[model samples]
Target: MGKRIRVGMADLNICSAPDSIITLGLGSCVGIILYDRVSKKCGMLHAMLPDSTKIRNNGLRAKFVDTGLEDLLAMLEKEGVRRSSLVAKVAGGATMFNFSSSSEISGIGDRNVDAARECLKKYNISIIAEDTGKDYGRTVEFYPETGKFEIRAVGRDVTFI
Candidate 1:
C-alpha cells in the first residue's frame, strides 16, 4: 500500500506513483486532480471558490480555482511532469441547499465546477471524468499510479471518475 497524503479544504498536494492523495468535506468546494501518466505524478486541489478576485481575502491561494490550478501546474512542471501529459478529473461541487432567492453564495457549487472546467481548458488540459452536483458532501481519494479517482459520500455508492 502506498502512502496516502491528505489534502485539506482549500489546500493542495502532489504525490508520485505508488502513493495517493485525498481530500474531504467537499460540498460547495471542488476537488481538481491532475495526473501525468508517464511520470506517475499526481496533484489534487480542493478549491472553495471560483475566482479569487471576487473575494476580499484570498485565504490559502488554493481556495480558489483560478489561482490554485495555475499554481498546481507549476508545481507539477517543477516535478518534471510534462504539460502535454497532464490529464484532469474533478469531484464535489454540490448545491447542498435550496434558496428561493438565489445569490452568488447559492450558486457557488456550479461556479466552482465552471471555474474548474474553464481554467483547465485555458491550460489545454483535458478533464477525463467528474462526479459533481447534488445536495451532499463528498470525500475523494486519487491514486496516480493507476489513475483511479474514487469518490465517497454519505448514503451514496462509491463512485470512480
Candidate 2:
C-alpha cells in the first residue's frame, strides 16, 4: 500500500501515489495540489501568505505563496515527476475575517488567490479545477492516480477541486 501524507498549516509535501496528500483548515490560506496522471505522483502545499519577499527568515518560507509553490515543485521533480505531466488544482483562499476597512488582513485571501494564479501561470501549469474565495475554511484531498480532488468547505457543498 502507498503512504498517506498529511500537510499542516504553512507546510508542503509531495508524494508518488493517489490518496497520498491531504491538507486542512485553510482559512485565508491556499492549498495547491499538483498531480501527474501518468506517473500518479502528487504534491500539496498550504500557504498562509501571498509572498515571501517581506519575510527575511526561512522559518516561514512555507507560509508564503511564491516560495511554497517553488519548493513543492522542486520536491516533486526530485521524485521523478515531470513538469509537463503535472495538472494543478487549488482550494481555499477564503475570506474568513470581516472588516469594515480595506487592510492587508482583510485582503489576504484575495492576494493569496492572485499570487497563486500568477505563480501557476509562470510555471506553465494549467489549473484543472479550483474551489476558492468564500467566507469559510476548507479541507482538501487529492488522489493523484485518478487526478481527482475533493474539497470540503464549511456551510457549503463539498466540491471536486
Candidate 3:
C-alpha cells in the first residue's frame, strides 16, 4: 500500500500513482477526487460547505465546493496534467441531522452534492462515480493508481466508486 495522505475538513491535497488521498468524517461536507487515469495524478478536497460566496468569512479555498473544485483543478494543472484529461469522483453529503422544524437549515448534504455537480459541470469535468446522500457519515480514500475511490461507513460494506 502506498502512503495515504490525509486531508482534513476544508482542505485539499494531491498525490501520484502508488499513493492515495483520504478524508474522514464527512457528514454534510463533501469529498471530491479529480484524477487523470493515464498519468495517475490525483487531487482530493474535503469541502465543508456548498458555496463560499454565501459565507462572509470564507478564507479557505477548500472549504466550499465551488472554490474547492477550482483549487483542485489549479493544483492538477500545476502538476502538468491537462484539464481535459481530468475525471471526478464525489462522495459524502449526508443529511446527518433532523431539521424538520428548520427547513432552511436542512438538506445541507443535498445542497453540497448539488453544488459539486454544478461546479464540475461548469468546469467540463465529468463525475464518473459517486456514493452520496444517506444519513451516515463516511470516510473516503482515493487510489490514483487504479482510479478507485473507496468509501467506508459504519455498519456498511465497503464500496468503491
The per-prediction CA RMSD against the true structure, in angstroms, equals 1.1, 1.6, 1.1
RMSD of 2: 1.6
- Candidates sorted on lDDT, descending: 1, 3, 2
Model 3, 1-161: lDDT tens per residue?
Answer: 78989999999999998988989888889899999999999999899899899999888889999988888899899999999999999999998888767575677889999999999999999999999998999999999999999999999999888
lDDT per residue (tens digit) for residues 13-79 in model 2:
8877635688877889999888888888888889988889876775677899899999988998998
Q: Scored by Cα lDDT, where does model 3 land?
A: 0.91
Query: What is the model-wide C-alpha lDDT for candidate 1?
Result: 0.91
Whole-model lDDT per candidate: 0.91, 0.85, 0.91
Question: Candidate 1 lDDT, tens digit per residue, 1-161?
Answer: 89999999888989997999999778999999999988889999999899999889986799899999989999999998998899999998999887877887789899899999999999999999999888899999999888999999999899887
Per-model TM against the reference: 0.96, 0.92, 0.96
Query: TM-score for model 2?
Result: 0.92
**CA deviation > 4 Å runs, candidate 1:** none
